[model samples]
Structure formats: structure tokens, C-alpha cells
Target: MELLLSNYQPAVFKCNTPKDYMEEALKICETLKIASGYISSDALIDLKRIIELNGRPRLELLIGMHYFDGFTKNQYEAARTLNAFLQINDLGFVYIANTLKFHGKMYSFTMIDATKSAVVGSSNLGSLYDKVSRQYEADILLKGEESSLIHASLEEIITKIGSPFENVPVTKFVEFNQLLENHENVSKVDKDEKAGILRNLTGVKFEIPIKSKPKSNLNPYFGKGRENQRGYIAPRPWYEVELIVSKGITSQPGYPSNQTFEVFTDDNWAFKCETNGDYSKNFRSKDDLKILGKWIKGRMEESGALKMGTPVTDNVIAAYGRNTIGLFATKDPSIWYLDFDASK
Candidate 1:
């Protein structure tokens, strides 16, 4: 049990080599609020336990495009049961990437809450290499907001292009078995060999290894180009601001509890305002933001407020959850805090 903590430090773990990947991840999920990972058998047992626990957490697991290679009767049954459990709890859903496009093996898992953690390693979700006494594998747990961006990126990837990995409506189990038993060239091969066959068939490529750097004393959550906390808010690449042409909901991935606004930005980035210097209260409601978004779009299309508009630095600010009131011309630097009455 190699537990770790830090303001922005990342912990590393190993499995079947030095540590048990499943066990450590299970311990972390015991208090998990929201989690996302590449689905495999390595962590399925623990995922089941976590979902069954009280106060089921939100989860989204990515089922690789070639999930049927290691198909077995018992594993099939387990998957069926797990799918049922997930649907019943409404805690999460598994997704399968479009094989035609995404063919990479996703082996990452993330647990995001007040404290964030990310694990990237050599193990898949298979029991063969996930066991304590199995093949060698390792995982890294990155803590704090530094990890939030990565987790957010994963969420964007899964939800944007993947389809639900459901067994209902028409069970994938049958299709899986058919593919397994009918492939003359690979049917006789073991699960491991079948995995290789699937990869070959899909033209999957392993990600290139990244060279690690020495640890730095600077906070990982804050970028190196830190700005003073005097007046203007710092621009976060993760928290982008954009003017959405269409009316829709916008939310930051890891900060689920923060207030969300529908207000359109000059860029597609969601707006985060300064609410008395508090972080959580910076959010605005979608409906309220839409009012402002509609106004901005109308003005932009009319070429009125945006006559000289360069999308590069356009700004549509809104104010809510406070007493501040102001609207500004594009040239007005003082219009940094844009406030509009939603009631209008």
C-alpha cells in the first residue's frame, strides 16, 4: 500500500513487479467522486466494488475498439453483469472508440475530485497483467489541478468521438463470440495471440515513450509564467473563453461543482468571472449566459459592436452572482467585467 500525498506532487506505483495496481487504484476509488479510464479487466473488479458502494460516483470508461479479442464465457458474463450494474446505478457508462479512426490502446485512468489523480502505465485492463503476481506494470498518480487538465482532455476525447459500449438492445457478446470463433486465422490462437491479431487487423500503434524530467520545486498547478494577483485575472489555457454561435451548455471538466454559464465568449472557452476573489462562485448559469450569448451573436452578425472584430481577442464578459454592473465597447479596457441583467 504505497499511499502518497502532495500539494502538486505525483506518486508512482507498479504492479506484478513491485506493487499491486488494482489494489492501489481501488483504495483511491474508495473515496472517488468522478473517474474516467480505459476499460479493461485489470480494474473491473475494483470498479464494480466502487460502483456498488454507497454514494456511487460518476464514471466514464473507454472500451477499446478491439475489446472482444480476449472474449471468454466467464469474462463475457462478468461484462454483462457490470454493464447492468452501471446502468442500474446511473453512475457511469463504458464507451468504445470508433475503430475506423481511433485505434490506440487507451491504458489511462483518472480520479478527479478536490484532489486529482492520473495513472498512466504499461498495464491494460486485463487480469493477465493486472494481478499482483502477474506481468510487470507500473502506474503514475498525478495530484492537484495540474492533473485536472489531463483528465479533462480525456473526458473530451471519450465523449466527443466514442459510442456507448452497451450490451443491451443487441448484446455485443454474441458478436464477440462470433468474431472469436469464426476467425479461421486467429480462432485457434490464445487470448494473447488474439490480441495481437486484433491489433494487426486494426493497425494499432503504441504511443511513443515520453522522456521524464526531474521534479521541480515550482507548483505544477500554476504555470511557469505566473502573474501577480493584483487586478487582471490570469488567462488559463484550460479555461478558454469563446463566443458560441449556438446556444448550448458549457462546463469545465474537473470543476463540476463550479457554477456553469451559457454565456457566449469571444472564443469558445467557457467564462470564469471574479466573484469576490472566490473560485467556486465564479460560475454563471447557462440560461442566464444564453441571454448574453444571444445578444453577442446578434451584434456580431449585424457587424455593430464587432465592426472591427478580430476573433483573436474578442471579449464578451458577463456578470452574475454579484452587485457589479457594467457593459463596454470593444475598445474599453475598463469593460473587463461585463455584466448584463438576465431578466432583460
Candidate 2:
């Protein structure tokens, strides 16, 4: 057994990530079985491409988290797309675990030679290659007889509780959609109560640092000048702010993959946002890139925390009290909150 840590602590020690193990398995293993509590659209698409590249080794995915918070609307669509891919190729299948929220990250593989290998860890497929909001994870790799033992266990788990993804209940999906709408439909609340609601029911919330070089005019807030006739940069609307999401929030459910969606900020700014670039790492306003930058910097400017023509470096964000902006997701998928309060 070998322990895998995503952080790669102690440079000299030499470590491999859970992602590395999965990647290797996909490439060489003839059969790969995975059970994960969560998955994201981009991760599934990326996995699909890889499996195709490696000759489509049989792969089965068992999804296990519907009992708690169900999938985002986008995720449901992505899963359908993946199901089609699986069906057309007859390579493998996806199952949703209805008996319980299968929270285990287990991977078992059978190589061409019939030898087996297995991995058990905290990583979901979404976390394996998440560039933004990268998370630290731990997993163990097993081979030889140990791998064979885990393989049988995986089959047993599937037999006991797995249901085809196609067979997953529509009500399971509708429940989450309704939950979000309920949050949005709240009649009224005092300022404090509203704040409490946003914070308390948050699905996941984290701080995102606004990164910029100390001397360059290239702060995401400022303009990256073009040396042509258009030295003048354009202005934007509705407090634009773009952030790289970590641990595959875009992959999770609400945000969806590569599609423009509406989001209302805690400050009451409404805008359409999209995730772009490789692995959907670059997040910004769908219409213009500057919208995201303007939104965040505008808040600082309004609070006298920032001024135009000044670089938004680490010190500036620190002086403003927090080096990162807090993004909170409510049960309402379309509603989100932004926190610019001082860092506690």
C-alpha cells in the first residue's frame, strides 16, 4: 500500500497525487470501477476524452450523493450526456446509489494481464484535476492480492445498492431545484436575518484572492494595455468580478459547464456569468471580461478601500481587511452572495 497526498509535502520525499493514480489506471487498465460521492461536468467530460484516447477500457462509475443535497440542474444534463456516451460505446455504465449517500472514493482496476490494482481515498473524480480551488487530498494505492480483494468488494457494493443513472428518480433532482427556489422566494427578512440565512444555508463558501503584480498595470481590476491605436480601454457594467473556482465547484452542479447563467450578488448586482478556458478555470462575465474585475474593484472603490490607477496587490487587499473575496452559494442555485468585509 502506498499513501498518496495531493500536496506533495517535503519536496524531497516525492509523492504522487490521487489524480496521478486515476490517470494511470485509465491509460492501462482494461477495466476501471469507481465509486464517488460527487462528480462535476468538466471532470466527466475530461474523463470521457481520456478513456477514448486510451482505447475505451471498460469503466463504470457509481455516483452516491443524491440523498443529501441533490445534483445541480447542469449536472443532471451532463450526466445524461455521459450516459449517452456510455450507451453508444457499450464500454461501461454509470449508476446512482439510492440506498445511501455513497461517500467513498474507491477505484479498482483490472489490467490486460488480469492483475488488479485499487485506490481508496477522499478524492472525488471532480477533485482529481481541479485547477482552481485545488484541494488537499489523501488516497492509498494497492496492488497485488490486496488489489484483488478490493475489486471484489467494489462489485459487491454495486450489486447491493447501485441503480442505473438513467433510472435515478426525477424527484431526486427536483428536490434540490425546489430548495433553491424556496430560498429565493423568501418573503422578507431583516438585514441581520438575511445575512444569517445566506451564511447558514450556504452549500459551500470560500474566499478568493484577487491576484495582481505589484508594479504592472495588469491588475485584473486595471487594463492590460494594447499597444495599438486603441490604447484606451473600454468601460464595463454591473460590478464585474471573475474568480477561479477550486475543487470543481463548476463541476459540482449549480454553475454548470461552459454555459452562461444568471447570478445575483448579495449586494443586489445581477449579471450573467460563464466559466471559460481549459478545464473551465477562467470565470468572468459572459459579455465582457472586464465586468468581473470592475465588480470587485468597484466595491473597494465605493468603500474608499481602493482607488483607480493603483495596483490591487496583496497589500491593498490586506489593508482592506481581507486578501480574498468571500463567495457563498445558497440553496438557491441562481442566487449568490459576496463578502467584502474585513478579514477576521
Candidate 3:
């Protein structure tokens, strides 16, 4: 009747993920209702895709935290987009519980066969893919009679929390997004000025076209580096693989000014990077530079474009199409894209 979901996976202890339960429930359910502390744009997009693949299932997403802690422009935009898609298909709606603050996370699903199921606990809607943002979370998946029992209570909770949240037939998002962004700006002015990020522009695209280089400089595509691989530093391999940035691009706005940043790859991979050396030229993996090497080299190897552990010459890079990469900043600065494409 009840099952425990845990983010942590260890021997002897059964580990159930929120992703597992939700993904399954979404596929067979005729209607889904969720109340979470907050939501992510990526999560909304992903859920929308799943719902599309499954069938036309109505979804009512009630956001709680944004009403209190505030929301980013990206979140607002994502929610709007998903709502539009659902509306077009006559699927469902998204709402915010504004009158009263809410922090609980719960999901209830009504199956096509009339059975009900639910998940309740710390896991938010975005809790599935954000492995690094949150280290641990737990929840309970309820089914059969237990699920049906909770369904009514959960609807009541959503209704009470979302009460007075909006007038019938919402036209636009409340002024919460811009207000939060403005408040954040006011608070970060001094910090941004000092850090030289005052000119940082959100939702900006940055392309750093890296020209071909010899093995000594950009050794990942080539072979071993000009320097020897240190024994102790092989794990985080910070200096093991390096991609030097041009001075011109370094001066551009929206470039990561920090030494460390997270890049979400086009293929749904996350890589932590460090910008070191003079003028922040060294762009290498923050953890295990070898990973950077493996990713790039592996891509080429898979396509039979270049051999692994071989010198990736100018012709090779040019033939491969795109050598340009770097940060693609979003409205939420925390989410950056380091896209990988054969066509740059």
C-alpha cells in the first residue's frame, strides 16, 4: 500500500526514486495533480513531454514556495509555456497558492481505470533531475485504498492553499516574478559591482569559437599534455585537460566570472568547470579533467571522426563541424548550457 522513495542508494537498503514513481504514474494516469514547494522550467518541460507521449491527461500543478520565497523569470516563463501547451490540448492548468504560504510536496494520480495513487514528502517537481542542487530527499508512494483515501484530502489541501490565489480564468502571471527579480537586483548591486558582474546579462548566448591547437595546449583531443599527470590530482584532474578561452570572449557580458560553474550539456549531462590561469583562460573540468577529455574524445570516437588518444588536428576539428562552445546563460544564472553540436 505504501512504498518509501529515497534519493540515496546504498547496499541492503532499497532505494526508490521519485522519478521512478512519477514517470510510471504519469503514463497511465488520466489526471494528475501536484502541489510542490517550487518548480523548475526544465521539470515542467520534461513533464509536458511525458504527458504528451502518454496521452491527453489533465494536469493541475499548484506551486507553493514561489508565493513566499519568490520565483525566477525562467520559472515563470516555463510555467506559462507549459500552460499554453496544455490549454491548446485541453489538458489542464497551473496555479500558485498565494493567500497562504505552502511548503509541502505532494502528487496524486487518477488512473484511466479509475484507481488512484499518490506520492507525498520532501521531493519537489524539479527534484528528479537536479542531482547536484539537492543531495537527498525522501517520499512515500501510496496505492490502492490508501491512494484513494488521500486523493480527496489532497484536493482539499490544494483548494484551500490556492484559494484567492487567482480570479477565475487567469490571463497572466502575477507580478511576483519581476518583483523577485527586482528585489534580487537591489540586494546584489553591491556584490555584483565588486565581482564585476554588474553587466552580466541573463538569457544571453555566448559562443567561444576555439581554433585548433596542438597536443601540448589542448591535449584532451590529442594525447597526454605538455605536463605530466600528477598522481594525487588525477581524480579532480583540474589541470589534466584545458581549453583556453580567447581574451575577446572573456570581456563579454554573461560570461561566467566565477572560477567554478556548472554546464548542462545538450545531451543531458552536467559538467563542473573551472576557469583558471591568466585572464581566466583555462577552461577545464572542475572535477576530473579526464571526464572532459572522455566526453569530447568519446563523441568524436563514436562518430568515427577521430580516434581516441590521438592528436585532434586542425582538419579534424574543422571537419567535425563545431569547435565553438562555452556558457549559454539563462534568466536563472544558476542554469548554464554548454551545448555540444556537430553543427556549431
Model 3: number of backbone collisions:
1
Compose the digit string of candidate 3's lDDT tens values, residues 101-178.
Answer: 788888888888988888888887866643333246677888878877568876887787774233423344443222
- What TM-score goes with each of the models? 0.37, 0.51, 0.51
Model 1 weakest lDDT span, ten residues long:
210-219
C-alpha lDDT score of every prediction, in listed order: 0.35, 0.62, 0.60
Better-scoring candidate (TM-score), 1 or 2:
2
lDDT of 1 by residue, 136-180 (tens): 444444556546665776776777756675732323432222211
Give the winner by lDDT.
2
Better of 1 and 3 by TM-score: 3
Residue 229 of model 3, lDDT score: 31
Query: Candidate 3: misplaced stretches above 4 Å?
Result: 7-12, 129-134, 163-323, 326-344
RMSD of each candidate relative to the true structure: 24.7, 16.8, 15.2
Model 2, which residues run further than 4 Å from truth? Answer: 8-12, 171-344
Model 1 TM: 0.37
Instruction: List candidate 1 stretches off by more than 4 Å.
Output: 1-25, 28-46, 67-76, 99-113, 127-130, 167-344
TM-score of 2: 0.51
